[model samples]
Target: MAPATVRRDPGTVKPRIRPSPAPPARVRCATKRAAVRIAYVFDHRLPSTGADTEQLVHMVAALGEAGADVELVLPRIPGRQVPSPDDLAAYYGVPPSFRVRALPGPFPTVRALEKPGFAAVGALARAVRTADLVYTRNLPTAVAVRLAGGPPVLFETYRPWPDQYPASRWLFRGLLRARGSFRMVLHSHYAMERFLRAGLPADRMLVAHNGWDPRKFEPRLSKHEARTRLGLPMDRPLVVYTGRITPKKGLLGVLDMARRLPHVTFLLVGSEGEGSVEREARSMPNVRVEGWTDLASLPPYLYAADVLLIPPTAAPLSKVGNTVLPIKTFPYMASGRAIFGPRSPDLAEILRHGDNAFLVEPDDWDAATAGLRSLLEDPETAERLGRRARADAEGGTWQARAQRVLDFAAPMIRTA
Candidate 1:
């Protein structure tokens, strides 16, 4: 069943669609280089509530804001209403800066159809000469475009397909050796190192970490104001985790920590669907497991937290590489609250121990409990960590991150 609609924030204005063939690309005149015309090709249905979908919308919006003539080439499912620019902008809390070009493809309702639409829309995107470079997460699509005598490809991914995905690693390596200035973007150095070891030249791959849209987090509501809005308690100390309520994300650790520390109220604000994890997490006496809060309504819950908790488990997903870093880290940092999180290499890239955040051994439930308690007990320390974190977050804005990506890919885009 569809969730009830969230009332739009009154202060927010609808994105203006300038009368043109599409919205006129905003170009910063001071930039010496020409605006890079980018066709960001995607394989999924739009306006969905996935983290990757959010990342895509925010990334393209920032790319557009950074003075790129960007267009999104996506699949067209016959019966579905294509998500309009306003819908994308409004849903993601971003500016309507890029255009969407949807080409006819098979609807991915069945297992066999999931991979078909991507290559079709991608090939069509390249065939039309709509962009000087086709940027995609689809590695195979990148190869297809290059082999079809199309323009340059800037492939982006969180997975290190070049090294680990046994089937494609060999093919990708071959592409690297036979290529004409091939380029790729990875989300973290952890992923980048894999590509480097796999014979992708150091200069060919970039680590463009995922970022947050500041509008969703900025002009932050105060703790008191936010608590009142969310109907949370004022008398008790509250710690919050505002993402998926899965064991892979370390929710089981959160449950154990909650049981050990009954004095502190634990709130889990983003569970979707029912499962043993969800049932067990909700059944905890002191924990409040709210189901699937919409994007627009989630910030106040963060603002209301005394401490932002991202529990650390010994090993998530057991063997396969985990989603090492959580996207919530950005907003959690942006919230200006002391974050209590895991000590992992991926998070180590951005979060510092004893600097902006207090980190404890992942899977060390006792240590996490002790650390969280210590943070909550000391208000001065908490405030200092939060201030430093917020200051650091200013540098990690999506606008800033996007500019860096453009700068990294600038030379490649130019020659293409």
Candidate 2:
């Protein structure tokens, strides 16, 4: 190759454009004098759903904010590729200390569960060696914790496994293996009570509640504003029901409530798998089905709502729903909307028939309808109730939640 001599004109005023240096790589670091490391195992993989991803993001941020180095490991579907570099970069957008790692599963169902072999054991052991605590999500990660035995484990269970999946019994046995070594974190008093009856030691149990963002779901928005944002009738009251469109969520009861209260429009937000409530609610005219909403987009819908309905069905499908309180409770209350549900002990602490919330007996249309009518007819009472609900929700943030976990694991945290 022949080199050509380049000539520069002395009089030429070249554009003074400086190439933008590659954007500096962003890094999140732990702030504690001695960073506490936590391994958080959850159900989120790439392209995750709304609530699962939101909970994962919140926990990661909370742990990082509390000066802990938090790393998340979620199971990946079999044959699915790991997240791309750009995806990995986006995942790391969380606090610097929050790292997202994906483990492979052979089959789509329980492949993320293949962590007990020697190779898998060694990898987990190495990770656990540096970790002060292990926080596991559902049953799958609970199994992984039993295999990796370095740190004190804290299992965050939303539902009892055996009830949801018959196979869960085998998986739950793993908990017994880690019984003395691990602690269970219950989301509601209902869960605490149920697990206590199941024989888990009281000393091994702790409760951490969930919360919401006021800017997203609050009374700050007028009916007209919320309606405009959500594309609903500005004059009509909006009642919202969110969560998996399944029987346990009490969608049928919500539909019945909608039927009784023809004056209000129902907003059903959630998705279904093979057979779902969304499929069943298709015949309703007053009900609007929004399959699923991202965490960032939930506020408008919440603001547009006049009330948050939680008519849970009396189904024994899983211990998860029956025992654990739904995170929706905090958001529903935080939205400054009246909350109507059965007198569940898990949620009883927050509801007062005519105070912060309205307690309706399960499938009690007469009672639920009566409560709805009172709130709709009297705006003053509704506003008062809504305000009280919002005030009560302030105590349910993830920070408050993480503090409880730390308090329960104080012995291990101090050692770490």
lDDT of 2 at 197: 54
Measured against the true structure, the TM-scores of the candidates, in listed sequence, are 0.87, 0.77
Which lDDT tens digits does candidate 2 get at residues 19-80?
22232232222333456677776555654554556665666666665556677765665677
Badly placed stretches (over 4 Å) of model 1 are 1-25, 28-35, 126-128, 178-181, 314-322, 414-416
- Consecutive 10-residue window with the lowest summed lDDT within model 1: 1-10
What is the C-alpha RMSD, rounded to one decimal, of candidate 2? Answer: 12.5
TM-score of 2: 0.77
Clash pairs, model 1 backbone: 312-363, 314-363
Compared with the true structure, all predictions reach lDDT values of 0.73, 0.61
Candidate 1, lDDT over the whole model: 0.73
Clashing pairs for predicted structure model 2, backbone only: 28-96, 105-111, 159-320, 160-320
Residues 1-416 of candidate 1: C-alpha lDDT, one tens digit per residue: 12212222323423333222233456532355556688888878887767778778888888888878888877777689888877788676678888898877664565366555567557655433546677787765677677765666778888766545766767777665644536888888877877777766877778877776666764578889998988777888899888766777778878788788877888887666665566775556677777665565667888898898877764642344556466788888888988888887778888998889989987778888898888899988888988888888887888888888877776656322
Best by TM-score: 1
